[model samples]
Target: MTSKRVFIYAGGEIDPISIKSIKQDDYIIGADRGALFLVDNGIKPHISVGDFDSVNAEEFARIQGFSDEILSCDAVNKDLTDTELAFDIAIEQQPTEIIMVGVSGSRLDHTLGNIHMLLRGLEQQISCFIWDRNNYITLTDSTHIVEDRGYTYASLLALSPEVTGINLEGFLYPLENATLKMGQSLGVSNRLVEAKGTIHIASGLLLVIQSKD
Candidate 1:
């Protein structure tokens, strides 16, 4: 089987540790200023897409030459955010999975907006995630198995009315056949007890967040 292609978004406030975690084989998609982040980190993206609002003139000029392809858009436009536009391009490439970085931090509203994009990807059955220094977030509607490495902590939150028949194993606190409601904090701060764990939800959509110190 072919390995999944991982797409990284260049946003502001990207953790260097997260950038290092990117393997040499992973694909990269830069969004506006995110392209600048890749250049600073000594990595050239496979494709760069967005309006060059956050990027300064010099940085934008530099990356324009390094990227495999550049898809420029108007700085002020309707329809989708720059990040979403980049994601659309990523989906077209048919990556097995996508990881968005530099997406969370500095602006709470923008972070929330990107999180909603994960929901949209979930609707398309695309395996997508949002990552930063302390958090790993994903949206899911069906049963999924999450492998726990010792690096981060994990939790599940209901995005819909209620998530039913939820099962969690190999964690500090495990739950079975439980119901998680929206706006509740019942599933927060769960740690992996074993090397790996699984989360199974029979119905409804959920947002899974894995964090570390």
Candidate 2:
């Protein structure tokens, strides 16, 4: 049976955590060269997406054999990025949660674009996360209970121009009805004092990042 969770892997910097998060029941999608990664790792993806311009004929053929479904488009004619195309497919299933992996890398534009894609989850009321070896990231517009998942630091940032009435509980540096403005580094490197911390925001979007060196 298909699970309520969807995991989309894109061509980028991958870490063990991203691969390790896969479970037997997960609906896995490989975008472009990401399919090669999955197939090489001995896992067949449910769907393979993108124009796959990054792969050679042999690799593409291997991905075709390994994937149950394929969604392809012309690389030059397509408007969406390969990762966004994979995300579009994932959103169609209306899963309870969507996890994006291998979307962050040396390319600053791609990384930031992927991060911005999390806003779609907030708009659709679906939980979304970007997972990497050293960082786990999500966005919220309201109250949220953040559990410490063995990460050493938790940070909050205002995704909008400003986030108002922010309150943090069980954090080493607690805030009370404070405001956070974008372009400020005041919220960086906070630690969870308790096993679970609470972040409440009255208005605007906030990005929560849990990371470790």
Candidate 3:
């Protein structure tokens, strides 16, 4: 069986054309101004979720006109960010992959928050990834494989204090049952030697960053 993918748009900046080629079989959700961003780019999100405070009346009205469903949250008294709310909704659908968009912007706090939100999906065994024009980030624990995407570089960083028993194969810089510390930069700027690559970890969380020039 094929896995289902969900594309979620947060209020961060994004280039719609980056994902313009994505097929119509996936689900789409917009958060706050993200909904306006989608509609402005002629991309119709299946539903929009978030507090209406971020977007102005004109943009909110515009979203309401075209979006299938608009879930408005209270701005002042809310526990979750718009993107988190969107993730909560996406989780309900039992998706296999969650592609987060418009989540990496100037706001450092929100960007970090969105990254940690992957843990929520992680617990549910959903393969959540953060994608932008130049970056692809995914969180992994234990063993994982990364195909040689024919890209420029791939990096692995420790999400927890330390990731032990780390192993890397088919990469420019390979590791063999090694341990990586959280603040270490040893796993940065790795290249692939073959068509596919593999990453294996025994404990702790790891963040894989695949990028191209």
Candidate 4:
């Protein structure tokens, strides 16, 4: 399964502590500064896609020596960002899932851009997730199984404006055939009541966030 997974390291805030959850054999793609992050985390990226602008020459050389493939781009007048470019390479592999790290940080614009990548993957019918220390985010148009993995809370939001006939099983605050809207906070910060949690959606897309406070 690791060979079929693609792990993306983006040029955002990274905490090595959270990397323990990542599988060792997944194909790693480094986006700009993420190449350095990979080195710090004791892993060399399989493919690195980025312009050399963000990384210094010496460090870039070090990363190149460690990387299996390096894709260099221009710093000016680029259509896609470094992270987006990495996604292109990951998608080409036709993997089972794409897990992206170092995506959320102080840069609001970049964070929003990272989210668009998830939507694109979703359109491709590929499983995509943006993970951090406390958040495990995934989107689905149908039902999903949620199990207790030490996640303290769970939230469900309508990613497609209107998610109808929503039913949540084994949740502390269960919802039976409820309608979740885009601009609603009714489905935020709910906990699990059992070892397994189940969510059923009849129509529209749903974003499930299993998180720890």
Which prediction has the highest TM-score against the true structure?
2
The residue pairs in collision within model 4 are none
Across residues 29-62, which tens digit of lDDT does each residue of candidate 3 receive?
Answer: 9998888888888888899999978888988999
Regions of model 4 farther than 4 Å from truth: 1-3
- The digit string of per-residue lDDT tens for model 2 on 1-213 reads 334899998888777556776888788999998889999998789999999999999999999998999898998997999999999899998888999988998899999999999999889887899988888899999998889899999999989999999999999999999999999888999999999999999999999999999
Whole-model lDDT, model 3: 0.87
- How good is model 4 by TM-score? 0.91
Number of the top-ranking candidate, with lDDT as the measure: 2
* Candidate 1 minimal-lDDT segment of 10 residues: 143-152
Model 3 residue 147 lDDT score: 71
- Candidate 3, clashing residue pairs? none
Tens-digit lDDT string for candidate 1 (36-74): 888777888988888888888898998898899898888
Q: RMSDs, each prediction?
A: 1.7, 1.8, 1.7, 2.0
TM-scores for candidates 1 onward, in order: 0.92, 0.95, 0.92, 0.91
- Where model 2 places Cα greater than 4 Å from the true spot, the runs are 1-3
Error of model 2, residue 189, in angstroms:
0.6
Model 4, span 115-148: residue lDDT tens: 6678788887788888776777888877888878
Sliding window of 10 residues with minimal summed lDDT for model 2: 13-22
